[model samples]
Each structure stands twice: as C-alpha cells, then as structure tokens.
Target: MGFREYRGSRQHTHAHFVLTGHTSFEDEPPLLEELGINFDHITQKTMTVLNPTKETDASILGDGDLAGPLVFCLMFGSCLLLGGKVHFGYIYGIGGIGCVSLWCLLNMMSLTGVSVWTVASILGYCLLPMVFLSGASIILSLQGVLGQILATLSVGWCSLSASKLFVSALAMHDQQLLVAYPCALLYGVFALLTIF
Candidate 1:
C-alpha cells in the first residue's frame, strides 16, 4: 500500500491511498491500526460521481466544440430579427439559411471531431462559386462601366465578408460571440452602398 496526503485550508483535508493488491474496506482496519491511525468516529455516507467519456456531450457544449454552432445561431438569429423589420429580403432569406446550415454543420462536426480548418475550407469552396456569380450579376445589372465596377466591388465585399464570418465561426469554437461580427460590419457597408 502507498499513502499520500493533501493539505489545504481547514475546510478540507484529502488522503489518497494506492493499493498494490486487492483489498476491501473491512481490511482497512488492520492497516490503519498498523499506521497508528484511528477511524472509529468516521461515518459512512452516500456519494455520487459523474464520469463522462465523450467530450462533445450536451453537458460540455460551452466547454467543448459545440460552442461554435451555438454562438453562430444566436448571432445570425439576432441579425435576422434586426434586418427583418427593414424588409431586407435577401438578408432574411439566403443569409439566414446559410447561417443556419453552418450552425448545423458545426454541431455535427463537434461530435465527429473534424478540424475547424477543414470546415472553413469546405465552406469556402461552397461559397466561392456564389461570390463569383453575385459579382457577375451585379456587373450585368449596372448601366455603365463605372456603375458595373462599383456594383461588382460592393457585391464582392458582401460575399467576402460572409465568407470571413464562416471561417471565423469555424476557427474559434470557444469564442462564438464574434461569429457574425465580420458579416454585420460588411452588411452595414453594403447597406450604405445601396443607399448611395
């Protein structure tokens, strides 16, 4: 048998015992007696211990990988509410769907232990084509060369900002509060461009 003692404040004192062979609680008496320790006044009480094998379980969401999606959902949901009243149909529809999809992917990946960089790269691949398409559409919708250039730039900024948000969300699972921060800033700039 091996013994270790832990000292702390008066409220708690801990002792750890390591046994080399099988022994029962009843066998402790002789060992205690030999060690000049007494346990006559000690009382037995019920105690419960919780052990978790999976790191992604619901109980560990905030401390685990699930924090990424949880934060993304909240940020996107708030954006929807704010933009909804303004009748920004594109923001409410396509943007909302994209954010929700990203959130779902994050949740699934949390259980799978997929790397955040992989998630970000996949999202980039999916969004890159759309970025090109949106830019082309904005250019074609404009009347003059200058107008086409400005519109393309504006749409490109919006798309790039959205892509950055997805990347940020995937990379920083623990810091979800800023998941949509980049998107929101870009959205504000896009709104200003639309007004001008």
Candidate 2:
C-alpha cells in the first residue's frame, strides 16, 4: 500500500512546518498571535539581544512566553542535576523571575521607548548567562563564597553588556548605566539566590 491522496486544492499538498516542530521565534506570532497578545517581533529581536537607543523596542516578545526560555532552562538545569545539584529547578525558576522583573522595571523607569518588547528582548538574551551561572554555581560549589560571587558577577556582567548595547541603540547618555547597573545587580541577586 502507498500513501497517496488526491488533493483538490493546493493546500492539500502543503505541510505546516509548525506542526512538525520547525517553528521558532521567527514563525510563532502569525500562527499563535490570534491565541493571545503575541510579541513575535520582540521575541525574535531578543535572539539578537542588543538595544542601543531609546527607540530600541523589544516589546513584541512573541506568542508563547515559555517557548524560548523553556528550551534553554531544560538543557541547563538537566546538566546541573547531572553534575549533582539536586535543586536545579531553582536555577530555572529564578532566571525566569529575573527576566520578568527586568521587563517590568524597564517599563516603569521610562528608559525605553515604544512598547514593552525591548525589555523582553534584553532579558531573553541575557538569560543565556543565567544558564551558565546555574552551571557555574554547581561546579564551583567547592570554592565557597568567592565562587558564588563570581557566578553572580557573571549574570550581572551579562546584563551590563546588554545594557551597554541598549544604551547605544537608544542613544542615551553613558551615565544611564547608573540605572542599568542596579537593575543588573537586582537580576544578579535573583541568580545569586539560586546558588546560595
């Protein structure tokens, strides 16, 4: 027997890649945008993760909020548990909270223009370091307080790097980093709690 079909329309010959898992930040908004407030543009931009000006808008974080981070966390957290940290979930959870907080703070501070997506972009990309911090905290546990600080520092440094790109994109004064550093520190504290 053969899998043959007589298609009456062009649609019958076409396959939806999304149904087969080829979907990415690039494809979700159009298909799932109707599902809710889809921020596809914002989410895709996060993949690049730079915002150098006030006009750098990252508010369109795509359709599924869980889409990007879930893949990242699963891989990182599983590695941590394999390395013997049974509390790996804490890393995943705290990283998520930090991104949400980043989004909220950017909106409140009036540092960004346009919609809330730009912050989403910044945090989404920044979370990559948080994943590393999770692994570092687990591996560096033998180093005590110094290792913990270093791991947290990695997360903070990541945020600062993103902030610098964001400042450049937004064309803001370099002094705006005074605001950026504390925000990054707050994100670091969230990551810090995971290790300690």
Candidate 3:
C-alpha cells in the first residue's frame, strides 16, 4: 500500500479493519476474492516454528506476504502529525507504537508455538485499533487521570481484538492468556503514555 498525503476532505476511517483482516487469512479470505492476500499454505507451513493444525494446508504466518506492518508505521506517524490534538512530541505518538510493537514481537516467542514474522505482522495489523484509539484520545483532547483511564481502556480493546486472531494464527489454546499477558503490559504502558 502506498501512502499519499490527503489534499481532499479528511473524515478519517475502516479500510483498516479490512486490511487487518487481510493479514489474518492465509489465502484470499472469501470476502476479498478479487484483491486480497493469497496466503500460500504450502510455503508458509515450512516457515512456522510450530504447527498445531493437523491440516498441512492451513494458513500460517508466512502464508501471506503483504506488508501490513510497514503500512501501519506510516499510518501512525501520519495520524500523529495530522491529528493536531495530541499535545506532545510527535515522537511519542510514532515511537510509542514502535516500542510496543518491538516488545511484543520479541517477547512473543516465549509461548510454545509462534513465529517472529507472525507476531510482528499480527501486531502490525493490530496497530489499527491502537492508532485509532490514540487518535480518538487526542482528537477528543482527553487528558489527566481521565485521559489515562480511557487510554488504558483502549489498550484493553486492542488486547481483546487481537487475542482471537493471535490465538488462531499461533494455533494456541487453553493457555491463550499466557500469550496475551505480555500484550497487556505493552498496551498498558503505551496507552498510559498517550495521556501524557
């Protein structure tokens, strides 16, 4: 995806939800038959650290080759620069996401079955909700304790939104919370920082 500065009227956005959904599937999700990721199950399986699926044809992390995470970085930076309501360093907006993303991508391997690419891609795709929440927090001009509270709540939303897919992609169950815990902390820190 290319990034273009909008000269037109900007109402702001859900292509994000669709795009994120694109990252979740190994092959063209039924909804996106025309222009969607064609996750190659055969190639992807060879790349994963673990495959809990009995079916070898299942879509794993490397199945799809779209660069959703890279697009997200640009979106985040752009939102911070454009949103205007966030009254802090632009680095805070952009860099906070990077930091949280890095932490999750790195620590996610502690679980039994996960791939670095999948973790990064999932977190990258997951950036949609986090960025939107931050944008909303800034756009609404939330601050002080109330701001912190709302920011933290947004983190919860990201965690919940991401958990289902993360669990599925990693083929984890029963102990999914173990995987989710790190995400909670990363979100907690970044979400609170948005208030400051």
The candidate scoring highest on TM-score is 3
**lDDT ranking from best to worst?**
2, 3, 1
Worst 10 residues of 1 by lDDT: 43-52
The local lDDT score (0 to 100) that residue 53 gets in candidate 1 is 18
Model 2 residue 54 distance off true place after TM-score fit, in angstroms: 19
lDDT of each: 0.37, 0.55, 0.54
Which lDDT tens digits does candidate 2 get at residues 1-196? 8998987865522267545655546754575555443456535444454333334443333222544545555656665565565655565465556557655655565565523344444455555666666666555662577766766566666666567545554545655676577557756664655465
Between the candidate structures 1 and 3, which one is better when assessed by lDDT?
Answer: 3
Kindly list the per-residue Cα lDDT of model 3 for residues 1-196, writing each as its tens digit.
9998878785424786566565445654475445445444323432231222333333544334335555655665566556553434543454456545644554564355454556656555555655665677546766666666677666766565455446665555664576566666666655654554
Encode model 1's per-residue lDDT on 1-196: one tens digit a residue. 8787877675322332333332446655576456532232110000000111112222111121222323333343344344332324543354445445555655564434434433332333223223333344343433456545655555454444433433343444553334344433434433333323
TM-score of each: 0.25, 0.52, 0.53
CA shift of 15, model 2, Å:
20
